[model samples]
Target: MADDTSGLSVPPKKLSHSELKEYAPGLQPRKMTAKYEKQKETLLRDRKSIQQLHKQRVHRGQSAATQKYESRMERKKIDREKKLYPRNREWKDADYFIDQYLKREAQMKTERVRARKIQNVEVKGNDEVMFVARVAADFECSPKVQKIFRELRLYKPYTAVFLRRSGENLKKLALVRRQIRVVKPIRQQVEDLIRTRGFAKVDKQRVALSSNQVIEERFGEHGFVCIEDLADTLMKGDEEKFNLVTHFMWPFKIDEAFNDQSNKVPGVGRSAADSGRHLQDKVEQFPFRFMDSLMEQACRRGKSRHWMGPELIKALPSKKEAKFLMKVKRKKVALKAKERKIQAKFDAIAETDRKVARKLRREHKQQREEKKAAALASKNKSWKVAMKKSAKAKEKKEAKRRGEDRRLIAMYGKKKSTAKKRPPKKQSKVE
Candidate 1:
């Protein structure tokens, strides 16, 4: 009974560490053997922290990549916007151009007045310049456009030139804007292009301007002794000096296929995924689009290079030429109307002749068909008569043959019933 009661009784309440120590007074609690478990817990916390840091690093990488991609797309969108030129704004009629010219003249007057008050300079038409490159990608251009290209020394695809703005040059560009690319090169770009691709005309032949002596020998009369002198004159934008220097130098040859920047010091010309974007950015101002043309881009102000002369304004808008063109256009319209009236008269006569011919063809076809029907009916009637005669002859011959048989049968005394006999049976084996 005692053992059963001890077994049945609940164990004395277990004390916590502090309670057991207080109850025991001087006795110490057992040291915990959970070092391995504590170590595992600590390891788990450290691993969790490491994983968190890794997640953050990965997230940062992903975010940076996303931002870079988005920025690139945005830049492409802006480039496309700058490059796009609507066709409706491209080719305006004489009336629209006349209005534009009048407005431009009025605006120029205001600009001149402003310049006089501010800078005390007597501003004239316009000081304009441009970089022209012949793409020759479009061959369907007019002969006039080709003539302009030849005059500008843009003889082949990728041929390039620096053209100072003038009324004459503007007219040429207007005639062949779609077949060319126009750029407004800055000082740095101009220097690079000249140093890398400059040429001199010697004895009516293209020679590279690699040395100052060659430049001095070719252009010494014009005081352009060195390559620097040539570049300086061009940068100055003087109409006369610019023209002489450009004609003196052969047209530049740019590579549309090789887009990578020419080799130079590592970081200078290199960029992330450069892929010739730096070079492409040089011409981003006047983008190559189907409807967009350099002639139109000359009007818009941009960040680096801008149009500042009346050459493009007057030429693209056809300032003085608009009136003359309008008169010629009226004459052309009158002539076209007269020609259309004459064509209408001829078409009416042709239509009448076609109707008469069609009626004659129908009558001829009907007469031939009628003759063929009569011939076929006569042929069919003759064939039917011949068939009838052949049937009668056959019946008479049958009757004669039957009479002859009857006579022979009578003479032969009934001819033993005259029936065909069956073949004899084979002899039996027993027989």
Candidate 2:
């Protein structure tokens, strides 16, 4: 120990090993306050106690490795549950499924051929898609056309429906061909709708086909796990699967009113397509244009693929449409401005006449009010006169009943002092 320099003999304090070591030029040991040291000690003690209690409660004595393994196995179970019924995610069973689909398609083809033979109608281009729109409103349509519209499920104008290019279906379509325009469906527009606007039935509820789960759950037996697979099935004319999917999906509501109305010739009965009335040249763009902005909004929300069906149905107009509307709106504003100017000019020219007309109107109103008051006063006087006449008649009748002079009382205006005091009715003295 080093000797003490003070007069009193005091022991020199020993420095800690950490403190004994020289740090870098400016670096020094952190100075700890008494409160800080106390807090650190208490925290360490509490942590130790918690760990001991946790260990005691977990009597299973499972180690970290075992717990980690159990958690991993639980995750694997969830992943397995999420997997398709086949247990294999890949389309390994696609060949057998395709064969099954082909067999059904062949059966449908045979049925259609038999139907065509009976109907004596030939349907060409089996792969072509027809886009049909109802040009007539339900209220104005004929009974026969109304029944056809009901069958097609299009009861309103701007309503669109799709038809397959098959013989029997084409025969049905031909019945309403005049009312609806049948055009070739655009592949891009169709694909976009299938991708964005498509829905699948889940638990009897219409759920959006955002994830592959609903498609897999419903169509997994047929080897379809996603939208692309479903589209391919429809393209290949897998009748059963196609019908099931179509029934599951809701009808596409298309608004073709966004097109130009100038082409609507007053007497012409032709379609807008023939008359060049469409706002967009590409017919396919109509549906996608109405639905594109909505899909973009959905995508922007950074939502997971599990969005519901109604959200996808909320279609908004596009920038081009907004511009068209703005142009139309400007014309409307100009017309309104012109009308307002005409109205103002008429008001200015007739200002003095209008003031004189107002004075005459006020005078007529006052006369009407005075006439009404006079009529009311006359009614009251007539009521009082009637009451007095009724009273006089009643009094005369009473006087006549008593054998008194009713005529004399009326002429004299006095009742003859209570009718001569009833002449002191003669009474014989009873013996």
Q: Please list the residue runs of candidate 2 whose C-alpha ends up more than 4 Å from where it truly belongs after superposition.
A: 1-125, 201-205, 256-431
**TM-scores for all candidates?**
0.36, 0.33
lDDT per residue as tens, model 1, 139-176: 43345556667898887655678887655565556556
- How many pairs of residues collide in model 2? 0
Worst lDDT window (10 residues) for model 1? 263-272
Q: Considering summed lDDT, which 10 consecutive residues are worst modelled in model 2?
A: 304-313
Model 1, CA-based lDDT: 0.65
lDDT of 2 by residue, 1-431 (tens): 77554444332477564544432233456799999999999999999999999987675566766888999999998877764243434454876779767865764564455334435533342554555665544433446557767776676665665556554555555444435654454666666667766655567786777888877777777787777776665555556766776666655544423444543333324333343334234445455332221123333443311221222213224468669989998998999899989999999879978899999999999999999999999999999999999999999988787665666666677643554455577899999
